[model samples]
Target: MSYLVLARKYRPRNFGEMVGQEHVVQALTNALTQQRLHHAYLFTGTRGVGKTTVSRILAKSLNCQGADGSGGITATPCGVCQACTEIDAGRFVDYTELDAASNRGVDEVQGLLEQAVYKPVQGRFKVFMIDEVHMLTNTAFNAMLKTLEEPPEYLKFVLATTDPQKVPVTVLSRCLQFNLRPMAPETVHEHLVRVLGTEQVPAEPGALRLLARAARGSMRDALSLTDQAIAYGNGTLAEAGVRQMLGSADRGHVHRLVEALAQGDGRTVVETVEAMRDAGLSAASTLEEMTAVLQAMAVLQAVPARAAQQDAGDPDAQEAARLAALMPADETQLLYSMCLHGRAELGLAPDEYAALTMVLLRLLAFKPAAEDGATEKKTLLNPAPPAEARPPAPAPVARAEPPAVVVAPQLPEPPAPAPMPAPLAAELPPPTSAAPAVQAAGQRLPVVDAPRRPAAPTAPA
Candidate 1:
């Protein structure tokens, strides 16, 4: 046999072997054990999260016979049985798999429906497994509705799709739908370790962790990248080799870059970018790596316990935590925003290194300057009006009067002002020896009279 690819070689044959998707497995297992089988089933999730895998497992569970050929429908199939072996090898007469991506026409759907009428050749039930069923045409879906909703007692329909939205709601409502979520990084990491162990391929835990993250919740992708890493490292996976293979920036570099950004060290940041460029690392990858680091920093800053638990396996968790402490929440958010936006700048710039340098420097540029220096710079550059231009505000006046009215009132009759008001001096009376006068505004001014001089005082004058 041609060298089996790692993905196919390690394809999960049983639900117990599948990684993640526990909710789906539990429900299916319970249904199988209770013999509460649905005529039609729909599995939805991103690629390689085990939608098709679950379908195949269900097929085997329904048809498998024990080693002595005495088994019936069961949640756990005996691999030694003819039914299980044939299904695992993809040679089962009763189990049929259709690629809707290729056979998506109405005629193809009708052809498959025709097989639904016939009974199982040997097994207790006939299984129809359709992959990428969402790719089927509207007319094809219409053709499938009747049979899918009400198949024969001995026939089962299993449909799998990465996107369930494309599947008609009418069809979706008729089937037992199970959504398989994308596997978490930690879950993917553990799965990789198991696979590598089985293959006897020595791998660094950190290397596997990086592969898991890069896979983005896809098992096939994780396996494919692991294969590449193994090849790159001559069958022994190491962090340095995997990083080189992925063209991914190292966490050490990412940490240093973030630290410099947090500390407002523009020179160091630029120098780091220069080194990355010299090493021929991708600018986009640099930004992406930094974004991941910033995201972790934010999470750590927000929930210490959660971060502690999640980062327990990470060798750099302490460094990451320390960086989180040194960086403020606001700056962390800012740097995250910059890294996200900087990814787009990579394609626009003539040289990615220059783009990266500017992107890293952007954070430093935004750092708040000292209050005194900032104020002085602002004042010197944009000085306020001189004293002559902006004279001291006129002394506070109680009521300001217009020197002259440019436009008179529009009333038909002019306002009457015949009364001659007393002068301001008359408004206030002279001070008297008996009663003193208060001259301030709004105060009562008392009348005053000079005291009469004696006759002897007049002679002396």
Candidate 2:
């Protein structure tokens, strides 16, 4: 027998078997139970999220007739019915599926609409399912509008698109649109466990967890990876085998890098990068893995209880919690951001490993300097010198004094003077002073003698 690929082999057969789409399932199931079925429906989501799978299940539900040929429309179809079995096998005549990606033209859409007028030949209702409906052109979309809005009572339309924005509003308005969400890692992991058990594959839980994360919320992707892991492990999955097969960088490398960042060990960080390079691991993958670890660390740090609640089998989670305790939450967030952005830089550099080495060392370069050790000593020694002082001068003494006063000597004078003249005669009588005119009448003159006064030495008179 030929080997069928895991993606096709594990495809969901019914609504109950579909994973990670409870919202769509619950709504459709309620609608069926209430008998309020819409003539046209639309399913939109990312790939592997069960858009097409749900459409098929819905088709089977609307068309299935029981083995006794007495059943009516039901949410849970009887698989024994010809319609359900044939639809599950993709060979039902009443159900038609179109890959809009290939048959997306005005002519193809008109041909599909032409079939809407005819009635169901065998099944209860004819189902027309279009996959990737966003690929249709504007003209094709225009062709689909009228039939989609008012289809024949015996016909149902199911349209699926990975990108809904590309589908026209005219087309969107005619159908009841439902969005399917991507599965969480935990949901994907649980589903994988159920699948592995049914396949009788021996696997470690750690290996399965790794596969779940690698799937990134796509069950089809998870199962495909699981098949590859099982084959690599020869039907028994081991963590080492799975990691080696996926070329997954070891989480220990991430732990060491983060611990070095927390402890401010630049040398250890460089050494860790060198070790990763020696082990032949991709630098981009290392940074990506480290970022994942740091994110987990931040979560555990924010909610301390999560540290205790982690699965011990995942050494990475334990390491994340440990690093979270050692590093500040702010630093954890910073390093996580750096690691994520650094992955893009790896390809731009000439050597990716070297670029990765620089990225690892970048955190050490940014580590804040220590503040308390050597700066305090210089301020204490060698005090300022004292100001200078001068001496005072000596006081003066008193001297002896002299006593009393003394007299000085004098000098003498000399000589005589001329005598004065009288009025008439020197010695006339004192009674009458003669007049000089009478004496002068006679011409010749009378020489008047001076009335002499005695000149002598001066005396006290």
Candidate 3:
């Protein structure tokens, strides 16, 4: 009849099919296996992270009859059973899916609660699944409070919200809450590869990786982007086509930008930005791509053995490793910080490409002063004060040391000259007594003559 999107086609039907959220799955599976069923459940997380999916699976597990029609409460539901199939197709009589975002008034909530008084018609329990429950009004939340807190034994409440903080505590306390975490990049990557294989699509590994990273931990988003990438590549996904589709610069360009920054080459940085602008690529995406490379380079720099074993055949890896060697650890940290803060300023700038260019050049401005080939290298930050800041202190210190040695020999020489000049005032030259005149100022005006004559008589006596 109609083409099914990959997101819906590959939706997780059971807890076992769920990826990247084992802790929640384990707890729910054990609870179901032990028959410890809660009347109400709350699933909270960001959008596209399977809040609705888990709610449906739990609904099926509660109601599924086996293929032979005898199954009761199970963690895994047999998809062929009428109960499971209906739940999967959203046609089950007992399961009610509400979009609280659209119907958030008290009237809508009161209407849903009105049905809780009745028992299940086609399943073991009647499930009320409200997606984006946080969007409901305060009065709406108040209307559901009494019924949600103490619902009929046959009724189950499944509340899902992306923003749990907005959910009222009175309603929250009545249900068992589980938070679904975002998927890891590796997990998303592997899942994309599996999907492409099933579709008979020949996608390059690099293309899948770009999709995985671009997905930012959303499997549905990843699959959606993959569909677009496939179309962009004309049903054959290649790295070049995917890169163009995402408007990302070549990995080679990212490498060159980082390599130039590490080498403090401003011209290369400017030219690279120019090339990206000319190619009509996004400035933010270019910075985003460089951020990824800089992160990897930091990782490589942290682990040298890993750097040595980088994929020799891959040009991107080779360039990254080469940059890892060229950039010291501190500068790597600096460049990483610059890229992070620069991305935020792009919108405020008049020309985003000019902002991107300035961002790339910022690394050169912050280049570690130690990297400069100087015998006395100064740090770019925390520079030393000028040597003459304390001019008086050092001047005295330098001059005070030499006079100590000069004074020792001169102390004995001066006394001998003083007595000799007095004893031989008549035989010796007047200059012999001149040395005492230099010291006579403290004693008297004529002490040079007066004291030497008196000292000459006292010495003989």
RMSD of each: 13.6, 22.9, 11.0
lDDT of 1 by residue, 184-248 (tens): 98898998988899999999888988899999989989998998888889989999889989999
What lDDT does candidate 1 reach at residue 178? 93
The model with the greater TM-score, 1 or 3, is 3
Clash totals, every prediction:
4, 0, 0
Top candidate by TM-score: 3
lDDT of 1: 0.84
Q: What pairs collide in candidate 2? A: none
Model 2: residues >4 Å from true position, as ranges?
Answer: 373-461
Order of candidate numbers by TM-score, starting with the best: 3, 1, 2
lDDT of 2: 0.83
Candidate 3: lDDT over CA atoms?
0.85
lDDT of 3 by residue, 278-314 (tens): 8999988888888888888889888878866765755
Per-candidate local distance difference test: 0.84, 0.83, 0.85
TM-score of 3: 0.81
